[model samples]
Target chain A: MIREFSLNDLVFLLEALRWTVLLALVAAVGGGLLGLLVAILRTLAFRPANWLALSYINLVQGTPLLGQLFVFFFGLPLLGVNVDAWVAASISLSIYASAFLGEIWRGSLQSVSSRQWEAGASLGLTYMQRLTHVILPQAIRISIAPTVGFLVQLVKNTSLAALIGFVELTRASQIITAATFAPLTVYGIAAVLYFVVCFSLSQLSQRLERKYHAPR
Target chain B: MPLVDLADVHKSFGAVPVLKGISLTLEKGEIVAVIGRSGSGKSTMLRCINGLELVQSGRIVVDGIELTAPGADLNALRARAGMVFQSYNLFPHLSVERNVMLALKLVRKMSTEDARSLAHAMVAKVGLADKLSAFPDELSGGQQQRVAIARSLAMQPTLMLFDEITSALDPELVGEVLRVLESVAEEGMTMMLVTHEMNFARNVADRVIFMHEGRIHEDGPARETLSAPRTDELKSFLSAVLH
Candidate 1:
C-alpha cells in the first residue's frame, strides 16, 4: 500500500512544539533560581546547611528523571496528591535540572580565587557583604557562557517528558504515526522540529560565549 | 603607649612554623620597614597583625584592641588596619572608582553621594583620576597598584600594611607605585611595609627591622641599620644586595 504524507499530521506536530518549548522554559527558569539558592547555600553555609544542600543535590542527581516523573504522576495519587501529567513533568524536570545546574554553579563559585575573598575581608566587608559585592559579580561573568550552554541541554531533555503522556512534540509524533501507520515520516518531522529549536539555542549560546571572550 | 604591640606571637601552618616568638611594637605614625629573605616570617608577621593568620600563642594588640582574644571584633580591627597585597587584588569586575568605594559604602555605611565623592577624591589622590572608569585588567600594573592603595586609603585606616606591594610590578612600573607609597608615608600615615626596595627602606622608613629564621635579627634606625656594620648577617645581606 502506498501511504500519503498528510499536511494534517504536520499541523499536529507543529502545535505540539509549543508545549515542548513551554515545558523547557519553565524547567530552565524555575530550576535556575532554585539551583542558584542551592549553590549559594552549599558553598557558604555552615555544617548543617551544607549537609542539607548536599543531600538534596545527591538525591536529585542519583535517581533518573523518568523514575521521578513516574513517582510524581503515578505514585503521588496514592499519597493524596493529584497532579496531572503537565505539572508532574514540569516539577520533575525542574528538580532534575536544579541538580545539574547547582553543581555547575558551585564549581564556578569555587573557581574564583581565594585572594579575592582575602581582599574583600581585609577591606572590612562582612561575609555576606563580600559575597554580594565582590565574589558573585566576578562569578557571574565566569558562569554566563556555561549557563547558556546548559539551557540547550535542558531544552533537549524535555523530550523525556513525553514518556508520561504529556502530549508534547515527541508524544504527538507517536500519535500521528499510530493513526497513519507511517512511523518514519512522523518521527522524522518530530526530529527536525527538535533540531531546529535546539540548534538555534546552541547557536545563540556560542555567540554569547564569543562576545564574552572578545577583546574590548 | 605603643600604638601596636605583639607579645611572643607564634603561628604554624600544619606543623610548619611561620612565625616563632615574634614580638614588636610601633608607635603611632611610625613607618616601620620589615626586610627579610623569602620564607623568613616577614609576611606572616604582617598578616598576624590584621588577624588574617591566627596566632597559636601569645598576644597582638592594635591601638589597645586585643587581636588574639576570642571575642574581638575582627571586622572592626580590619577596618582600622588596611592591607595592600603584592598582587594588587582589586576587584576585576568593578571600575577603579567602585573598587575604592565598596568598603566605604558597605562597611562605613556612607551615602552614595558621599561615597562617590570620596572615591573620586581618592582616585585623584592616586593620580588615576582619568582612569576612574577603567577596570583593573585595563590598567597598567602600576596603575592597578595605585588604585589598590587608593582603595585602602578610602577606609581612612589608622594603620596600613604593605606586603611587597611593588614586587609584582615591572621594574619600570615599580617606581611609580613606590612613589605613591612614599607620598602616603610623607602624609604621616602609620605603615608597616614588607619590602625588597632597600633604598625606600633607607630613605622613607622611620625604623628598619630585619628578620631571619622567623625572628627579628636586627632592629634600629633606618640609616644606621642599612648603612652601618652591625652584624655578620646584616653586613652580608647588604653586600649581597649592593653587589
Candidate 2:
C-alpha cells in the first residue's frame, strides 16, 4: 500500500537524523583522540614510531570506507563477536576519520617554524614544555580550518552507514520512499538536513580562523 | 675560573667542517665580539657554547657546568646561558611582556606577580617599556630585537650570546639595538656576540676574536687589533665588512 508521506514519516526522518548526528559526534570525538596520538607519533623524531603512525594512516586511507564497514560488520561475526550495525559503522567511520585527521594535524604540527623549537629550548623549556606551550598552540591555530573542513566530510560520509542497516537519515529516507514512492521529497529533505549540519560547521570554522589568527 | 671555556671543539654539518679544533675562553664580564666573513664559524662557536650545537670531540665548560659530558643537563645549562638570534625570534603569538615572562615563569618557577614585575623591568631596560603589550609584528624590527633581548635578560643568565642580532635590522635601526647592548654591557653582563658592526665592535667590545676559515686568526684587545691588524685575513676582513 502506497501511504502518503505524512507527518509521522517526517518525524521518523527527523529521529533518524538525530541518530546520524550522534554517529558523527561519536566518530569525531573518538577519531579526534586517536588522531592526536597519531599526529604526535608521526611528528616525533623517532623513526620507528613515525613509521608506525604512517603505516596506520596508509592502511585505513588506502581501503574504501564501505570495505571497512564490511570488514567490521561481517568479519566481526565470523570471529564470534556478534556486533550490531551501529557498532560496525561507528568503529569503521572513526578509524576512517582518524587517518585523515591524523594526516591533517601532522602537517599542521610540522608547519610551525623549526626555529620556534630552538627558541623554546634556549629558554630552558623541556621537550614536553615546548610541545605543549610553544608548538601545539600555534599548530592548533593552523589546524582549525582544515580540521572543521574534515568534520563536514565526516558528517556527509555518515550516509554510507545506511548500507549496513544502521538506519540513519539516509536509511530512513530509503524506507519512506519505498512506502510513499516519493523519492524526490524524501531524498531532498535528507539532502537539506545534511546541508544544514555541514554549512554550520563551515561557518564555525571561518569564525574560529579569524579569532585565532587576528593580528594583535 | 673562566665564564666560558671551549677547548679543541670540532663540529661538522654532515661532511663539511664548520669549526675546526677551536679553543677559547672568556673571563667574567668580558664583552667579546666575534667578527668574520660568513661561514667562518663565528656563529657556530657561539651556538656551541650554549649547547645548541653538540661538538664532535671537545670540552665546553660554561659557568662551571661541563656541557660536553655524555649526559649534560642542557636545559640547566641553557637557562644559565641566554642566546639572541639574528631574526629576533620573539614568539609572534605572545605580547612583549609574555615573551619576556615565559622562561621566568616556567624555568624559574616564579609566581605570576614576580614574573610580571621582572618582565616590566627587563622591558624597561631594553627601552621598550611603552611597547610591553605590543605583539612582535606590531613593533619595529629594532623594538622586536630589544624585546628578544629582554626575553633573554629576564632569565638573568650568567652569559648572553648574541648571534648577529643586528645584522637583520635596517641601518638606521641598528644603532638603537646596539645602544641597548651597550646598556646591558654597562650592567656588567658577560656577552659574546657575532657582529658585522665594526664601529660597535671597536667601541664596545673589550676583546675582538677575528675568525678566518673556521679558526681564530686574531684574539686581542679590540682597539689594538682594529688599529693594527696582526693577520692579512683580519685586515682584509675589516676592509670587506667596512667598505
Name the top lDDT candidate.
Answer: 2
lDDT of 2 by residue, A1-216 (tens): 998889999999999999999999999999999998998899788999999999999999999999999999999999999999999998999999999999999998898898899999999999988888888888888899889999999999999999999999999999999999999999999999999999999999989888887332
Model 1 chain B weakest lDDT span, ten residues long:
B229-238
Residue range with the least summed lDDT across 10 consecutive positions in model 2 chain A:
A207-216
Tens digit of per-residue lDDT, candidate 2, span B61-157: 9999999998999999999999999998888778899998888999999999999999999999888899988888899999999999999999999
> On residues A82-165, what C-alpha lDDT tens digit does candidate 1 reach at each position?
999999999998888888899889987888889999999899999889888888877766777678778888877788888989
Model-by-model lDDT, in order?
Answer: 0.89, 0.93
Error of 1 at B68 (Å): 1.7
Candidate 1 lDDT over B1-243, as tens digits, reads: 898999998889998998889889999999999998899999999998988888999899997789999888888989999999999999987889889989999999999899999999999998999998998899999999999999999999999999999999999999999899999999999999999999999999999999988889999999999999588887888788778
| Candidate 2 colliding pairs | none
Q: Which candidate is the best by TM-score?
A: 2
Distance from true location, Cα of A193 in model 2, Å: 0.7
As for candidate 2, its interface RMSD to one decimal place is 1.4
- Clashing residue pairs in all predictions, respectively, total 0, 0
Worst 10 residues of 2 chain B by lDDT: B87-96
Q: For candidate 2, what is the DockQ-based docking class?
A: medium
